[model samples]
Target: MSHRPKTAALIAYAEALLSPEGQRRVEAHLAGCEACRAELAAIEAYDALVEDVRSVEIPTIDFASMELPLAREAEAVSRQMIAQRQRRSARPWIAAGLVAAAAAAALWWSTRETEPQAPPRAEAPVEREAPAPVIAPEPARLTPVVTLAAGEVRRETADGEIPLELGAVLDEGARVGTGAASELHVRLADGTGFRLAASSALALARAREDEIRLELAQGSVGHAVAPLSNGAAFVVLAAGYSVEVTGTRFVVSALDGTVGVDLSEGAVRIRPPRGEPIELEAPARWRSSGGAEGGAPRPVSVRGLEAPRVAPTPVRLADARMIRWSVDGIEIETSGDVQLGLAPGEHPVRAWDARGRLHTALLPVGGAPVELSAGALQADAPRVRAGHLDEADLRPVLSRGMRQVQRCYELALRQGTGAVTGRARLRIEIGLTGGVQRAQVLGIPESSLTECITSYASRWTFPPPGGPLTVEQPLTLAPTQ
Candidate 1:
């Protein structure tokens, strides 16, 4: 009927072998139960005593003292047995033998110790150091922003080249390229605008808070830089030259191992591969040929010529020979001479002589009448057709023709006495056989370059088209710098 814990419960509590709930219950009971507490204390003392006994060495027994009692008892038992045997029969002898045996067993039981043995000590748990904490490296940070893209443009990234949409974001170190007859317009986060012409390749070298650097591998680019904070640097690397500008509008062209820069507004500093830095202002141009040797900037004279009073005035050739004239890129029919009006900008006027030789002249019209000679025309220039001709359809042919003409032009520019500057327009007529049937050049003078370009165009073959095609294209040579 007692509510106190049993001896087994006390042992369980001492060894911490009870469940959490049972231990809590036993602890609560012990707090108000004095009897259980005393019992637990006695059990703990007994455990301590057992441990002490096991730790101490056993002493040698006093064999003489132990043997004397057993000897006296054995002598008494013998004397009684002899006395009984003399007085009674053999049954009395048997009873005395049993008595002596009982006495010996009692003596042995009284000599032994009454304490319980201690349990074996458990082996200490093997200690193992916890594995070192795993530390992970921090990830790299990247800043990317969306920019404008147009016309067969693609960006080269870590995953390979991806076609760019109108507002695709580009990260630092992204390389952008454009196909033939294609162009790209992009604006940076800093409001700087970049216009890349066809067949161009550019790499965004760095885009950071303090600077934005670009590398121009080939072709041309126009930069319209916005105002910048002090110490902000905008640099462009092209061929063997480097262009550094704070805030300006300029054009950088890297072609045929030469780098040319034309400043339209503000000023820029050009650093050649091996020469002193050359500073240029608006309306000035400079070029270098992949070396440290720097060249002087040349002034581009913009004469404000007047527009003609009459619209579509008579264009009379001094020889009065039958010829064809084109305003802009459109061919015009004429019996002996052609009558055309001049516009307020540079107009590419082309003429075809009787022998089908092409001549071109770029007429800068301000507000007056302008005249051009037949020899000032260039023939067989590449042109972009109107309508929805797929760039894929036109690129291969146009690219090939332009490349041929460009080589000839570069050669002539290097060797010819006169400066080969200004824009030239070429009107090409592809025949049914994919050969150039008739080619005319506009806005450039008749020279070895023109003749060479025409001869090359005449022999050039294009992929067969759905029909005969007419293409008029304008080519601009970098001005002397």
Candidate 2:
């Protein structure tokens, strides 16, 4: 049984002609050997086919010019000969070939009697089937939905921005933005959630299982990422760099041309537009210098951020019925004046007074807590005057100052940090007296560079509009390499 059984042995085994000892041995071999078993089954199938062929009745042949009695006699003789030949062969193999030949002859004779003769000059036509068409595969549909939403969260649609609610299924490539006092939490099918903070926005980009990527336009997003499988990734694109992770919890922000990351668990890799990738671990804070000239994100010391503060700071709220605040993505609600041991970073705080008016502010927490009065909180926000300038009056003034803007960028480059280049958005207000009222700049990380640009922009004068007119202009700086 080390090798395959011979052909004759196979035939003998199928016919039950082998001795009991031989039968036992072949059966044992077949039980273990698939190839040998297949061969044996095939032999059995052939024998069955031969028996079916022998059982077919041979029909009487009829000639157009011959008598019916003579045709009947010829058919009877053919059947007798076939049956006699079948009885003569005891071996199944020999019997198979003879039965097949006899069956073919019978079929040919029967077909001749039933078919009408074709014209001598005509030939049969051949038919062929067309080749199968090729079909392309469709892409995978990833359905990440809004699991939790608070305040004013909106998703961008064809019509415009619509309010985003819980359980709303988000489509791939959709852009979602949060209001000044809003929050949004999106969960993937795999149970990972990316919570967008107040005044933050991000595009879904790609949400496939293998890779999930988001483009952060502005504001902050806290990510509570689930453990990912091998070869899968989760990435956040902000400013000119990307923060990629496998499975971790962290917060990333892209505010005023700066990128920052605060990791509390797991690890992440930050890839900047320039320089090598930096590996950041848990219980650490990293931030890029938010200035016109973009700087690399480096490990920075935040007292309450990396770890808990040693002491709790007393926060006094006068005449407030309810108050609420959020740390990471978790929300906390309390009543009356309360002491909060908040970390020394920017945290959003909200309170409701006796009149039910909501007052919210981004509290810059220090080692000690500060008193927040209802009137003082209201007064902290600036008031904006109505704009009276139109595009026709503001376009030329900005065009003429392009060289001055370039000079400001050159001055920033000559400082300690080298090659400062990026796009900055400048917002200018023209007063009724035609002098620049107020100027603000965004997108450039360097404060000195922005100050220089804004300072020159404010000196530009325009024709009196009889009212305050505000105009926003975009500036780009590309230093000569």
Best candidate, lDDT-wise?
Answer: 2
Tens-digit per-residue lDDT, 398-433, candidate 2: 778777888877887888453666677888888877
| Candidate with best TM-score | 2
Residues 1-481 of candidate 1: C-alpha lDDT, one tens digit per residue? 5675687887898789999998998899899888899999998999999999999987988764555477567646644543333222112222234345655344224322221121112221110112222223222212333233333577887798887654355666789987764556565534565766668899988765567788999998778776656667788999868999888888888988889897877898998888799998887777675344244333221111111122222232222443555565534334333333434567766666667666666767654445555555556564433333355766787788888988887788778643678889888777665778887777888888778777887886766654677778788876345
lDDT of 2: 0.66
Deviation in angstroms for 376 in model 2? 28
User: What are the clash counts of all predictions, listed in order?
Assistant: 31, 9
Tell me model 1's lDDT, rounded to 2 decimals: 0.62
Cα miss at 461, model 1 (Å)?
38
- Residue 471, candidate 2: C-alpha displacement in angstroms: 62
> What is the lDDT of every predicted structure here?
0.62, 0.66
